[model samples]
Target: MGRVLSVNAREFEEWMQRSLAACEAALDGFVPIDAPVGLGVAMRYAVLDGGKRLRPLLVLATCEAVDGDREAAMRAACAVELIHAYSLVHDDMPCMDDDVLRRGKPTVHVQFGEAQAMLAGDAMQALAFDVLTPDSGVAPALQARLCALLARSAGHAGMAGGQAIDLASVGLSLDEATLRDMHRRKTGVLLQASVMMGAACAETPARATAALAEYGAALGLAFQVVDDILDVTQDSEVLGKTAGKDQDANKPTYVSLMGLEPARALAQELRCQAQQALADSGLPNTAWLSMLADMVVERDN
Candidate 1:
């Protein structure tokens, strides 16, 4: 079984490399290397050549797993990434998390000035919808659904709302349930949407869709749990960002709230839940998703 898992992992890694290459090309084309002026440069800077691109990978992988339209999936993948990038651009501003390093480089607000970063984030959000609701290619109904899902995930009831909770909870005691709820909005919702959006690219059945949603939710929570663990265990250089920043900011995290060992256990449990969801998904050959679950937990950065 270990040998079989290794072989499967190798195959999925190859697939992920190819998909990442394709995603890079697509993102480059959508968010051009050049724009009209300074704002254009900032937009490109915030998005191009940074970060893990995990969300986009989820989109494409789920698309393939569901036998969806590759072209449409690529579009959705890039769109979701744009939203992620925008959030980071804004999140690093002085008003928000106020960080200087991201993806091992200067944060957008630091690199491009706060105003430019803000504008770039705004533009990127608009561009996400533009990419989704193109004049041709993807079906109109599907486009609408994708647009709606992205909006909800990125809007008040999702990532934005979670951020609000995070800002408010700093220096305040939060119960496990409240912390979990906050992460479900801030991080998990978008991740969940990535899977659902990919499923939407094809004619997935209701059962497969539900199972994928479960997998995505578990994976999302696991991602945050690992992030919290890395915040304590890894250094700034290894993490490509400020390590222990969460603790410094007085922000509540899995590690801070539940302790390091328990947080680690929670991540493993979430990983198991994610894998179980995939098994129950009844979808054929979810090797990529399974590998991604492990990668999210095992990654140091």
Candidate 2:
């Protein structure tokens, strides 16, 4: 994989196109027949909004890295994306960030009313759990494990909790440890879960899973740090969301704690640290793991 992050390359372009196509196919019959037409439309928009498909891709990649049947991981892959889409939809709501744009298009709330947007997010979340339940050749035990891990990562104790901290910390001076805690739960858990789900199919050793989880933790935090830096340096067009959104929201960030230059440096350090974790865990011989770490820093948008 060589860890390249730009989308203009031929191989990456092909992968993204195929992934998005698969994602759309998985969403077929997603519309609820009795739901109001406006609400159904909102649901589709939220689930189908264009993105890098990074979470699902991570699932597929990690499954392959650990010698599992990559195809068997398909449903799990889509499940991750569905949950991610649901989170983005809710995050953009007026009750949340109130973001006006997502992936360069009007946010669900901007196109559909707030009530419809909320229903769409709820629907998307339901669909995510439904996808994971399908018999995709995943063992019953592994499926059950995946369900528990993903739920823990998504519900009140994980991403939801992290989001709560973020909302509460707005305009408040927070120490770095507190900020990291908020991000690790809110963002890192999902990333960790994605990798673990893939590894579960492989039935890798406990040590391997722990190693990958360490890598996941470092990369997830690095991803967030870079995002904060990009908000300070990039524009809305390139970012696809409103840039400086953290600042406008008066949210404390890595950039706020340290200078932009230092934040960038920290992200780079974390990326390297993540790669080292993979190596220390004996997965370093794998190119894709290291490549993903590099992409965390080199991604342009």
Candidate 3:
């Protein structure tokens, strides 16, 4: 527990640098020369930009817990990040959050035009698969499974569906149940995939996959809970994105529905549920997993 919070920022920086470097190297070799190269640059712009890399890190960590091959895990890790990056690119569009800042820099739509941001997201969606099924070299069945997991997480069953629900809820009175469904789709699905994909790399049993899925769901909701808490307490500089945007936009959130203290309590409970799910999976060596759960509950950003 002490070591998790004490993770050196320098080590995290180095790890991210290595991950981004490899992702770029793979893209550089495979991207078609006929394409204007601008697309690749935009892709780089979105991906190379700063982030916690939490989702991909989860993928890698879960894979290790399952005793899977690390190299194969990289492909899924990269895929999840691309999907995450693409979602952020679109999420910051003028039509969506319309924020001008992210990771302490201009949002993609602010730096590039909205059209470019949309295009970049489109390209990333395709490129994510380029990383997964082909580059990873999992068995055909596993590749199919990975692709399915990603599709559900990124598409209607996951992020897309969540965003749709959220957008619809704007300016409307929503209850706690409504908010939970919105988050479950928008954030929960991808997170569930992060753990599932890692297990997929190791060909984990159905039971383990189910357990990890539960962990991801609980963690995903917990992530939203923290985000809600941060919106009220944290500043833009610390958050690296617009804060209080939900309140400003009149969007429904846990803090708005449950109040500050209860929201925090719920987040803590969700984190514990997530941690317990992993423990019940019967996997070993959960140091990083515990760290991740702690970070989700305690993160300022």
Q: Tens digits of per-residue lDDT for model 1 on 66-142?
A: 99988888999999999999998998899999999998999988988898899899999999999998889989999
Candidates in descending lDDT order: 1, 3, 2
What is the per-residue lDDT of model 2 for residues 1-301, given as tens digits with 9 covering 90 to 100? 1332233446545655676677567665543535677767777777664777777767776776788766557777888887888899899998989999999899998898888888888988887777777665666777787788788889898889999999999999888999899988888889878887778777687877888888888988988888888898999999999999999989999999988988989988998778777776655334555666677778877
Runs with alpha carbons beyond 4 Å of true place in candidate 3: 1-37
Write one digit per residue (lDDT tens) for candidate 3, span 114-188: 887898889888988877767435677777878888998898878999998888888887888988989889888
Q: Which candidate is the best by TM-score?
A: 1
- The most accurate candidate by lDDT is 1
Q: What CA RMSD would you report for each candidate? A: 1.9, 3.3, 3.4
Candidate 2 segments whose C-alpha is farther than 4 A from its true place? 1-21, 28-36
TM-score of 3: 0.89
